[model samples]
Target: MEESKSGTVRAVDRALDILLCFTDTTDLGLTEIAEKTGLHKSTVFRLLASLEAKGFVTRDSSTEKYKLGFRIWELSVNLSQGDDPATILLPEMERLRDILGETISLYIRDGSERIRIQAVQSKHSIRRVAPIGARLPLYVGASSKVLIAFADMNTQENMINDWKEFIDISAYKDQMAGIRKVGYATSVEEREPGVAAVSAPVFNRSHQLVAALSVSGPLNRLTLENMKDHAGLIIESANRMGNMLR
Candidate 1:
């Protein structure tokens, strides 16, 4: 019975190893999994089969490559329903998306980078889309500016003083000034080329900056004139989302 329990634990570990291998890579073949996990091909295949049986993975019949399955998404939705920053913010984001007809995004400050936590894209043909997991420097995008504007003074100074990883020092003061004066920050073709974005900070019940809400699109739709026109609406949506959290 002890040996049986040990074997089961090992099997679970191997299965988890297979899942971990897919984190950074979108898809993987059996051989790639076996090589990356340092497991025998037969063991890898068996573990993958078990994962697939439980709906944790799916193998494409045509490509023979394995990717995450709908069950994973379902579980993610369940887990995020309570704890995700996106879950708390998406409804307001959707409303903003509907009104602006541009992509709306939520970003969280992660270390020295800002990560996209959630987004709603426009149905328009020429929409700007930033993948949910995408990460950017803490000084580039409007979301980053929002984060920086609200960050503790020590962190703000350290990040800006780190000259190696960041350029455009002059923009830091300008960004801070704009974010303070306008209650939001604008990224006119700053982060992604040909894309413009505006971001506002979200405050929690504690009045701490927890996230940022943003609107983005192609240059034609996100021009200076258009951004100025939509700025008030975007700020209002962000304020509503912040109020909801409180």
Candidate 2:
């Protein structure tokens, strides 16, 4: 019984490791996966075959590269159906959109990225690319900062170290400090070119950051001075969203 349990645990660990490898890259060959996960190539192939049979993985017949499969999407659909934070927050976000006359977005952390779950657009002609299901780096945009501010220390440290490609940690840290002091963050051209956003964090009953809410508009319309003016309103809207979830 002890040997059987040990074998089962090892197999489960390897399966989880194989699933995680799919998240780090766009596509991976079997050899590359074996190298990354330290599994024998034959063992990896068997695991991949099992996963493919269950629709948890797919192999490119031409290139032999493995990618995440449709089952992952199907699972996400079920998860999104009930207990979605977005569904709990959208009505408040729409009210924010109408009040601020800017695009309002709701985001949550998934792994190392912030995923936009909902966006309510204002009536303005200027539109943005922050549609539902869009992903953002954890150290760049206003929403991202709200996420980092409330993440675990380890994730925060990793983001602070590796996020220079988008925004430097020094700048983000300074921004976070200010947001903590003033209860909101305002960014100019952080994620989108010629766009500015003002964001605040949404907290769960446990005071964890379940999501972030942001109002975005063109730089000309949503300048730094203008953002400072609207900071109170933005924070209030976020507080209302946070309350609804609780």
Candidate 3:
């Protein structure tokens, strides 16, 4: 019985390995999985069958290839959410998206990078997409500015002093201070051409910066003036989310 249990464990381990082979790569065929896992194609097929039955994977009939399924995303959402601020903030983000008809995103600083934790793209054909799981520089963009504006003094100085591009450091420091003073920031083509965004900081009960909530869209729709016009709305939404997070 012990030997049988060990065999079952091994089968489960191999099945997990097959699933992991799809990591970073979107789709894979049976032969590709077999080669990647060094397992027989028959074994891979059997494991995939179990994974498919449980909704952990799906197979494309046209391509005869498999991809990670909806269940994977569902599980990963929970995994990525430590304090689950995204869940707490998503409703307000959706509200902002509905009101402005622009892409709404939530970004959190991870070391020197800002990561988009959640996003709701605008329904318009000419929309800007802020893909979730994207890691961007922590020193540019409206979102990046708002985040640094609320950061600790030392961190702010360290980041600015290490500026990756040539700019007036004194003026940039003043700009960051203005963001903190006014409660929001706006940018036009600062990070990407023809893209504009406004970002506001969200704080918890302790008044610590939790994230930056932003609305981004095409330049025509979210020009500097337009982004400023949307600033009040995003600031209000960010505060609402902060209240919930607190």
Candidate 4:
């Protein structure tokens, strides 16, 4: 019985690793999956077959690559159905959107990245639009930085280590300190050229950082001075949402 349980656990771990290998990309061929998971092609194939059978993965016939299936989305939706932050924050986001005439978004931490759970588009003909369900790196963008700044020290260190290849981790110390001191953050074309954003952290009933609320748009409309001017409003909105959650 012990041996059977151990084997089952290992298989589950392998399966989860396979699923995670799809994080940075839209699809992966068998060989790519095997390389990423460090499993033999045959072993990876077997795992993929099992996952495919359970609707956890799907294969594209034309490209012969696998991608996450609808079942995974269904599970995520079900898990979030009860206390999804987006449902609670949309009204505040809309209000901010109207007040600033820019795109507003709600983001939650997911590993070393932040995922957009809600968004309201800007009214401008040219604007930044980060769609719901989009995943962005933790080391870039104002929303992502707000989440990272409020995360625990261990998480902060891990993210900085993971992203050291692309960013100077040392440069973030003062930025994060300022965010904590002022309760907000800002970015100008850090993640995408010609875009700028301001963000504030939101907390839950227990005073835990749960999400970030951000206002973003084209650089022309979201210039440094304008973003600084709107920072207080964004922080106020985030505080109100945090109170509502509590």
Better model by TM-score: candidate 1 vs candidate 2? 1
Q: lDDT value for candidate 3?
A: 0.87
Clashing pairs in 3: none
Q: Looking at candidate 2, what is the lDDT of residue 241?
A: 72
Model 4 shows how many backbone clashes? 0
Candidate 2: misplaced stretches above 4 Å?
1-82, 164-171
Per-model tally of clashing residue pairs: 0, 0, 0, 0
Q: What's the residue-level lDDT of 98 in candidate 1?
A: 87
Model 2 agreement with the true structure over 49-103: per-residue lDDT tens digits: 9999999999999999999999989997777545677887788888877888889
* Top candidate by lDDT: 4
For residues 187-212, write the lDDT of model 1, one tens digit per residue: 87776789998888888767888898
lDDT of 4 by residue, 33-86 (tens): 999989999999999999999999999999999999988998976675447788
lDDT of candidate model 4 versus the reference = 0.88
**TM-score of each prediction:** 0.76, 0.67, 0.71, 0.77
Residue 213 local lDDT, model 1: 86
RMSD of each: 5.1, 5.4, 6.7, 3.8
Give the range where candidate 4 is weakest over 10 consecutive residues by summed lDDT.
1-10
Question: Deviation in angstroms for 227 in model 1?
Answer: 1.0
- Candidate with maximal TM-score: 4
The alpha-carbon lDDT assigned to residue 240 of candidate 4 equals: 93
